[model samples]
Each structure stands twice: as structure tokens, then as C-alpha cells.
Target: YMHRPAFVALLVVLIIGGTSVGTSAKKAYNYRMRERDVGKSDIVWNNDEYVLLKNGDINKAYKKIEDELGIKALKISVVPLEMKYDRLEIREGIATIKFLFNGQLLCFIQAKNDIASSNNVVSDRKVNSEIYNIWLDKQITIERNKLSDDQIEYSMYLSINGAYYYLYGIMEEKEFEDIVSELRF
Candidate 1:
């Protein structure tokens, strides 16, 4: 009975304090790692575009995209317009680019193939024609479709090249056009 209540209170305080300190240290370490990762990329925060790709070579960038997306023979180029993006991630045949402004989602870009055939409809006639054109080395098809309200989808089907690329996101019509205008190849 030597100050039993006091000893119990002290023990509780020590446990709580240790837990908080550990949590804080972990958070700080994660923040440092994120900063380091961002530094390794070819992005300068003060620049016009948030993601300024190194060397500005679309073909090289496309290879990176292909590896990330697990796709084969992806031959295309894109030059993004001036815009701020929060982060970009590519994993499991998908590339996601997220744009944020003041901690709010402005828009995003998702690039992937129609692997599940859920969004696209393909017929025998279309396949036969595509094959013929590919044999002739004229199998490049670029199409743009406007989805329901503030959403647009741009597709570039490279039959001969054996890859299909799509860009779709929720953004202003004018802004979307600006981005589409920058696409090359």
C-alpha cells in the first residue's frame, strides 16, 4: 500500500507517452522517405508542369509506361500541358496520374488496356479490317469520345504495334482539349 494509486497512474502515463512518441517517429520517417522518392524523379516544383519528364523523350517514357503497365509493343507519345499533379503511380498494367490543388482532387489520368472487354465492343468485321490495315502498316487509329458530363475518353489503338492506350478523366472540357492537343504519335 505504498502509494499504490500513484504508481498505477505513473505506469499508465508512461505507456501512453511511449506509444505517442513511437507513432510520431514513425510518421517522421515515412515523410522523409517520401521526400527522398520525389527528389529522385525529374520534377521541379517551381516549374510550369508538375511532372517534367527527364530528357523529354516520349519513346523512352513509353517504355517505362509499358514496363509499369505490363503491356507489350506500346508505341505512342504524349506531352502533357502545364499542370500541377500530386503523384503518379503505375502498377499491374495500369498507370494513374493524380492532379491535386490545395489538397483537393482536380483531375486524374488513367491509362490501361481494355483487358476485360467491358468498356469496348469489338466485332469480327472490325478485327478483320484492323488486321488488313495493320498488314498495310496503316493501323494507327485515334478516337475521342465524350462521356457523361465533364468526362472525356481518348483512345489510340495501335493494332500493328500490339497495344491500346486510353486516357480518361473528369476535367474541364477546355482543359481536356488542351491536354489532347499535346499528344504526338
Candidate 2:
């Protein structure tokens, strides 16, 4: 009957949608892998697939980094332009990203290596270099009656190599002041 064709078309649409959803989930997995790989470092390249937003101003770059990462920064002082050598293995690694927002002092990142072999490949467990990443579903709840809803929601990320640890949280609070004070840059 005429209805048979419509039913078959509906089935096809469902199949396509399911496949698309699966592909997106796979992409998310790969993205997490990439984030763990290119953690905070001293080399000057952003292989760590980030969503970039630009509005023709350098401050756009500063805002982009802060908004995406949800970290606080403090712009203390600007250094005069000077030529410096980049010895890190990372290709075109950012030597210095000079900007301060929130209260994070000397908030800049650099790459430590230049292993840019797999630019387009989707990350998979089969790939040997995938590092351990934080669980997305799990959140560390801070039990503070004084804190607001926004303050209670935080996640801790352990570095891939376990060199450093990070916690993303809101500013305008005293809890993070101690950590921010220790930053040298």
C-alpha cells in the first residue's frame, strides 16, 4: 500500500539520526582525549582543539580563553616587548600570552612538545597516547552552606602526566585567594 513507502522512509530517517548521534558521541570522546593531551604547558601552540571566538581585538583572545576555561585571571603588569627564544619542543608554542582576568596571575600556557602528527585523526582508545581524563559525569561537591549554587559546582582535573591539578570555580570569593596568591607570574 502507499503507507508502506512512508513507513520505510520513517525507518530510514530514524537510522540516520541514530548514526549521527553516535558520531557526535564519538567526537566528544576524542575531544576529551585531546584536552588531556595538551594541558597547561610552556610551549606556544594550541593543538588542544579549542573553540575560538574573535572580534578583531586582542582582548577578544583574553576573553575567549577565560570564558571557555572558566578560570579567573588578574592583569597585574605588562612587560615591555623583548625578543626571547622558544626552546620548548612544541611547535610555535606560545612563549607568553600576557593577560589577566579575575585573579589568576600570569595566566599563560605553553606547549612542551611539537608532536603534531595526528591533526585530523579522531582520538580512540586504540591510540597509545591517550591520557587519563576526568570523569565528565562526576562532580566534586563542596559542602559550604555559605556558598551559592554556582560555587558548589566544581570539577577537578588531574593533569595527564600528573604534574599539576586544576579546579575551575567562580571568582569574587575568598576560598580561591590562597591559591591565586601563590602564582609567581
Candidate 3:
């Protein structure tokens, strides 16, 4: 059921997409600390395909990421007791991974140094104090809106280990706070 033109177009699109993905192919990073600080570290902030991390242990994955990226990678140190958190991964960015919880894709976690405007890739809407609170006495910028009667979208920013992290996706507010509280430097 494919016309000649349609088949050719599909082939062209596949080739283009495959080519782009190839450019960002997975690479292994190693740490060799010198006099360089976090700000001056040479981290490849490039997009990469998902990699299954250290048996899905976040703490183990965090340690591996820190060692590999040659930076102080952030950790969701304690992944809310007994929650199904077997899906964790890391790319070559500000400590990023595709996080899953309770058999659902929770959000994309990204951490980078400094609170630069470039990092505000999330929405500009900010949630009020009633819906958000300062965790660990650290200021958190939040934006949330109900996507439907049962689903709420959340974009939250917080500082940890001298780097800024933002979580963006649809998840329960209570679940979000538990993860925030577990963030350790």
C-alpha cells in the first residue's frame, strides 16, 4: 500500500533521523581531576540515547555518572522507599536521565551548574507557595498546571550540590516532593 513518492519520502526521513542519532552515539567519560573547578570542567553537554544504569540503582548510577562525567553529579540519593525505580539512565549532560516510577515514566531529570536563563527551558509559569514549599530550606522555582481532570504537569527547579536541577513532566505533587527531599549534595 505504498506509492512510489510516499515510500521515497519515508526512506529519506528515516535516513536523516538515523544520521542525526549516529552523531550523538554513546561514549564513555572518565574523570581525571586537576585544578579545574566545576564551572570550568569539560563536560560534553550533548544529547545521547538512553543507557540502562547500574542495575537501576540511582545511588550507584549517580556515582558512576560523577566518576564518568568528571563533575559533581547530583543524586536523588534516596528514591522514595520501596517504589518501583528500576528504570534509570544517564546521558552526557548536566546529569540527566529518563526516570521512571511506579511503572510509569515520571520525568526527565537534568542538572547543570549555575542558574542561568538558558536552563529555564521549562515553562515560565511559577507555582505559588500554597502548592510548593522550600525543601531543605532551599528556594525552589516551580510551575504546574493540570493537564486534565486526573493528570497534572509539573516543572520544578532546585539547587543541589552547587548545581541547578529541573524536573519536567506529569506526576503527582506528593511524589515530586518526596524526590525533592531526598536530593543530597
In candidate 1, clashing pairs total 1
TM-score of 1: 0.34
Tens digits of per-residue lDDT, candidate 1, 8-113, equal: 9999999999999999877654521112135456332322332344324433445566566555523222333433445556755555455543333433233554
lDDT by residue for model 2 (1-185), tens: 99999999999999999999999877665633233224543222232243221111333444443454343322212221221112211123222343333433222342222344222212211211112213222232221222344333222222222122233333332333333333321
TM-score of each: 0.34, 0.27, 0.51
lDDT of 2: 0.33
TM-score of 3: 0.51
Stretches of model 3 off by over 4 angstroms after superposition? 1-56, 86-89, 114-118, 128-137, 159-162
The TM-score that candidate 2 achieves is 0.27
User: What C-alpha lDDT, on a 0 to 100 scale, does residue 20 get in candidate 3?
Assistant: 75
Model 2: per-residue Cα lDDT at residue 164: 25
Candidate 1's C-alpha runs over 4 A off are 1-63, 70-82, 101-160
lDDT tens per residue, model 3, 1-185: 66998999999999999987775553333323332124744232322222222224555556666776555655564454334444445654555556655555555455555444355464544583333333356656557766646667666776556555666656677767656656554
Model 2 misplaced regions, further than 4 Å: 32-48, 51-185
Instruction: Check candidate 3 and list the clashing pairs.
Output: none
